[model samples]
Target: MLSTKTLFARTVQTTARRALGTTTTRGKHTVPDLDYDYNELEPVISAKIMQLHHDKHHATYVANLNVAEEKLHEAQAKGDVAAQVALQPAINFNGGGHVNHTIFWKNLIGEKNGGGQLHDGVLKSAIENKYGSLDKLQQVVNGKTAGIFGSGWGWLTVNPSGQLDVVTTANQDMPSNIGHIPLLGVDAWEHAYYLDYNNVKADYFKNIWRVINWKDVARRYDEAMSKF
Candidate 1:
């Protein structure tokens, strides 16, 4: 509901106490700060885009998610099954938004901090084995992600079989919905690239690789592999 441009600009960032990932405090959801400055991902991503994406779009989801949760709890207390069911879409969309963006933010790191480099590790080995090389892996992910018809995400996930896979989700849907553990995710939504790349989303898709946090990807890969 907090979609207005003026209101979104005011969405709190660092100052608010947010539970990273799915954790919440006092039954409330809040926005967290970026690990790097807004401009840090520049050339690949503009400061303006990062600011709007994080402070406005992601913050709105967090705010709306809290509202939806409060409503759902009230409905539960009243034994309103119908109301509870009706609230599913709102909760899923906003909750997924919060969850996805938390991962998305961690998935990026500025080049100054060694963003794009894929170090030798389990993740790299998996990518090489599955797709031949990192470049091939990016191509596979880009192709899969660009094919998303509307707002969605492209993911490099580790499946239950412990195989690396490229997958896409429509509109804030996370890899967990399909029982996959996401190692890397690319936001294919227009808002993610409209400012910098305009209509050539493919260019954005390719450029995002330059800022990808492969170290984080590796860490995620190790954790996911442990489960399977």
Candidate 2:
């Protein structure tokens, strides 16, 4: 019973209010809180490693990302193309670091929790269809992850054709950069294992499966599939 012009004005006002709320609430990114304590993933991943990785390393990335974005905003406002170009590497490195670590935290759990348990669902079915079985999929992913020459990540992602695939990226790079939606990823950086595994990256890769949260991976898979 309202005039179309009045309806349009009300909708615009509502949208503007939402946009303002988002802008105020999302002023900057911060390190996300983990669902479990640092000591929870012990024997496989030590409490010391978790503390350094999350509180120190991941925190550094979040801070750097905010600084880089602030610089980018200033450069853009000033129409400084050269400054913007110079900031690209920092933005990419810190941005990818932030995004990767955010996903990484949710991808782990204590054994008592859902870790190591691949539920019977679409995600498991897709893996079996592509790699024959969950064991084979892990073996393949682990093998490729070990083959990385340096710091990187190993990912299970949905490719352009909507099929599941295993992939790797070097040094803070991500599956998103290569046009895939990562369902789950393992950090291949030495910092993730050096204190506990001590130069045994292969063993780290082998043991990481024990703490993988496949339920979270399945949820990510379902969300990614819905888009297609």
Candidate 3:
């Protein structure tokens, strides 16, 4: 017969295994399947680029995240807080890469079905109130994204007060770290568009609008607004 304390310890260990993504030693983090085919966002984004970005770059992030977590767990078991702290950057980088790319894939679609338009709604009003107009918001977002010195992201996020704001993060740092709720995030890492747009990041930024999924953005905005 097990003591109450023993049962509690077993339950905690089980939950920890699930949270660390190591329930099965042989298991690896899997790349999420896109809702649409690679070519589905054609014209706005190339199929070749999409395939490489999703299957290669984003897959690498997921793999690295799993590795980082494993290392962090080892450090924790040894009671080495310094080693655990050192692992923070790797965990943030890979974890953020996974999160940002996941949202990026969903926020894009073919333009034929009115994918990019921000119809009049709560989201539109919020944007207009914050940045004057959608075009203005795009200008700010594009400028911020292009200005990133290296790999990073530009985002339109909602603050706790429910006000829309444009912000940027260096490397893979997420908006949540800066006290903002990200509504839409644009990956500024060269790998995101170098194959298609080459050194012309501005061109890529400008063209991204054609595939922007306003519906998804609106949904995120609505949810964030509710939290305020």
Candidate 4:
């Protein structure tokens, strides 16, 4: 039988390969199928919200990214510097949207599953070292994420110093856009939890921890630290 670490290592390998587009076809970006059903993350995240967030919102980002990339290709071919410059925002917004959601899905699990559990591992140790305990870090992240005045994402990222940090990015901006490797991310946009939590963003932030896939996070942390 595989050890827990080995199994998680395999999961990380598969997830990383897919996220990097190594296993996907070139050209267009695509919406990935969740490992479980949309209803799997229930109570913490409703099926209606997941359905709309993934199938609708995320899918739209993928479509828009493909469109932007296609137009970008045309602009580059024609040496249209002005057009290319104008298209940068679209590419970044939609591309970041696609990237962010991809990580976001991998960051969650069903409540009955691994979600909400921060098992003993490198990630736990790192979190403890950074913020004293898992609970403390979660509070910090939730507070900062809740404080965002507009749509954005809250991320637990591996910083350049090989340390963990909780950071918030406005809009669809990715952590990688600023040289951080996002291990876990929570979408703070209204569409993510408005149907269930309404305008109470704090409740959504607090409840989201119940579905966090800490195994995926630890695996990601392991990989990121390996580079240091």
Reference-based lDDT, each prediction: 0.82, 0.82, 0.80, 0.83
- lDDT, residue 217, candidate 2: 95
lDDT of each residue in 162-201, candidate 3, tens digit only: 7898889998777877778888888898888888888988
- Supply candidate 3's per-residue lDDT for 148: 87
Best-to-worst lDDT order: 4, 1, 2, 3
In order of appearance, the predictions have TM-scores of 0.89, 0.88, 0.86, 0.88
Candidate 1 structure quality by residue, lDDT tens digits, 43-153: 999999999999999999988888877886677567665666676677778877888898899999999899899998778888888899999999999998989898999
| Residue-level lDDT for 211 in candidate 4 | 96
Residue pairs clashing, model 4: none
**Which pairs of residues clash in candidate 1, taking residues 3 or more apart in a chain or in different chains?**
none
Report the Cα lDDT for candidate 3: 0.80
Candidate 1 vs. true structure, TM-score: 0.89
Q: Which model scores highest in TM-score? A: 1
Residue 33 of model 2, lDDT score: 95
Ranking by TM-score: 1, 4, 2, 3
